[model samples]
Target chain A: QQQVKQSPQSLIVQKGGISIINCAYENTAFDYFPWYQQFPGKGPALLIAIRPDVSEKKEGRFTISFNKSAKQFSLHIMDSQPGDSATYFCAGWADSWGKLQFGAGTQVVVTP
Target chain B: DVKVTQSSRYLVKRTGEKVFLECVQDMDHENMFWYRQDPGLGLRLIYFSYDVKMKEKGDIPEGYSVSREKKERFSLILESASTNQTSMYLCASSLWAGGGGYEQYFGPGTRLTVT
Candidate 1:
């Protein structure tokens, strides 16, 4: 079973707009929520991450809002730019060294 | 900063052929992982190693095996290549936090095609 579910599959937005991706998990044991960004023909890179202790964490224009009670987390990219257009994936892990469960992925396209 | 490098960007192998994918990391991270990425499936872990010569199976490990002779290098071996095994393989490494709260750095990825 897919422990993590993400939506929508794809998203399109204008430059300067906000791009938001949401993820939910069924395993309460998962404590780490990390977002990865990938360009075509490239590997996924870490964008932002949050722990369950914090309800929200923000870094520059990227923010991760986590809800432990609801078992959900979302990534908000503010001031989206053309360079930011890539596939985004949110993953959760039960332990730091354990296997990770990933979402299907969200393809974000930012048009100028 | 940590850097992960894969041996090949793209490769092609014939069916029933033996295939090997190699990954190397600069940092002395204790954890190394191998994952396969497909169109709909985001990333599925095939195997992971916590230390040298130690390996564990991931979500999908049926047709794959892994080796880690050193802390910085991890290898994935396909006993027999099949068309269905064609996919983008990614290697990742992470410094183990005391608990399960560390981030993993990924390699560029290797695209493999089996005919």
Candidate 2:
């Protein structure tokens, strides 16, 4: 069973619009949440991350909104660009387990 | 900069043949992981090693085995290549932060096709 669930298997957005991907987890033990971006033929790279201690964390155009009460987190891309078109994965990690549990992933296509 | 490199970008093998996928990291990370990427299924971990000569099974480790003889190198082995095993293999390395999750750096990945 997938520990973390992601929504909208795929989505298309305009270059100047916003792109949002949501993920939910059932494990309260999960304390670290990170988002990874992967381009075609390349490996996934860390984009942004947030801990449950904070409600939100922003880095440039990417922001992570975490809801500890709801066990949900989302990535929002502001002013989406064609360069941002890639597959994004959400993952949760707990120090006790020392491993990351990843979501199914969401493919975002930003069309110019 | 942290760099992880795989032995091959693409490979093809026949049924019943043995296959080996190699990964090497330059950052001297303490942990290494192997994962397979399938459409819609995402990245499923096959195995991981926290140190040399130490390994742990992951979510999907039925058809695969891993070896980490050296600190910077990890290898995934398929004893008998099967068509169903065809997928993209990714290797990642991360530092061991005592009480928290650290970032993982990934290699380019190797796409394998078993015919």
Candidate 3:
């Protein structure tokens, strides 16, 4: 069974708009939720991460709003730019040294 | 910088051929992971090794095997390549975060095409 689910499969936003991607999980053991960004022909890289202790965490233009009670988290990119057009993935893990279950992904497109 | 390097950027092989994808890390981390990424399917774990000669099966380990003979190197082997195995493979490594959760650093990736 898939531990984490994400949506929508694809997104489109204009420059300077907000791009959002949401993910939900059922496993309460997962304590770390991280978002990754991937450019074409490249491996995914860490974008932003949030621990369950905090409801929200923001880094630069990237923000992660997490609702532990809801078992859901969303990534928001403010002032989205064309350079941000890429695939985004959300993952959950209990032990950082162990395996991480990942959501399928969301393809974001930012048009200028 | 924590650097994970994959042996190949792109490779093409025929069905039924044996394929090996090698990954090396420079940070002397204790954890290494292998994952394959497909469009609309995200990253799926193939296998992982926490220490030399110690390995574990991930979600999708049916057709793949892994070896970690040295601390800094991990290898993913496709015993017999199939078209379905054609995907981008990524390798990652991370150190233990004092029992706390930590993120992993990934390699550029190997785009393997099994014809």
Candidate 4:
């Protein structure tokens, strides 16, 4: 029940297209959700995050659509570019939680 | 920025050898974590420390141990390195109450290869 399941192990998108990745969790207690981006050899970086309090949150070209009742969340990348090609991970945690549970990553490739 | 640094970027070892991966966070955060990343299995937490001299086991803690002597430093130890233990090890840190929310800052990761 602590696991966060992510789908589409790999994705291919064209430049200037929209890229979407989905993740769902079994634990409804999870309130904090965040997405991370990792380059070829670097560590994953915090890109965007959303809480159950809001339905959606957007930052620049990256947006996170969160559904509280369904216990699911998604990351949408607008204007996908080659540089955006990387591995993305979704994670979740409950309120006053100690550890964060991560999902199986999605390898996104944006072709020019 | 929360700076999390690992001791090595790449490490090669033989089976039965002991290995130690060190991690340090500059921000003096209360929580530190160690994880292993594989192809299909994203990141699995091995251990974490909430404060100096305090540690907790995570999902996959078998064949691994950790040490947190100081607040800013956390170490993952392999008692006897095995071929299957070869993986990309990551270290992260975050505060109890962080900006926006609890966000982890990861290190560049240490790629360990046990032959």
- Candidate 1 backbone overlaps, count: 2
Higher-ranked by DockQ: 1 or 2: 2
lDDT of 1: 0.93
* DockQ preference between candidates 2 and 4, better one: 2
Give the TM-scores of the predictions, in the order they appear.
Answer: 0.97, 0.99, 0.96, 0.96
The list of candidate 1 runs beyond 4 A from truth reads none
Which residue window of length 10 is worst by lDDT in model 3 chain B?
B94-103
- Cα deviation at B38, candidate 3, in Å, is 1.1
In candidate 3, stretches whose alpha carbon ends up further than 4 angstroms from where it belongs are: none
Candidate 2 CAPRI category: high
For every candidate, give the share of true A-B contacts it also has.
Answer: 0.78, 0.72, 0.78, 0.67
Evaluated on CA atoms against the true complex, candidate 3 attains a DockQ of 0.77
Give the per-residue lDDT digits (tens) of candidate 2, residues B23-85.
999998999999999989889899999999999999999989989999999999999999999
Alpha-carbon deviation at A74 in model 3, angstroms: 0.2
Docking class of 4: medium
* Per-residue accuracy of model 4 over A28-86 as CA lDDT, tens digit each: 77778989999999999999988889999999999999988888899999999999999
* List of clashing residue pairs for candidate 3: none
DockQ of 4: 0.65
Q: Which stretches of candidate 2 lie over 4 Å from their true place?
A: none
Scoring each candidate complex against the real one, what DockQ results? 0.81, 0.84, 0.77, 0.65
Q: What is the DockQ (computed on Cα atoms) for candidate 1?
A: 0.81
lDDT of 4 at B73: 95
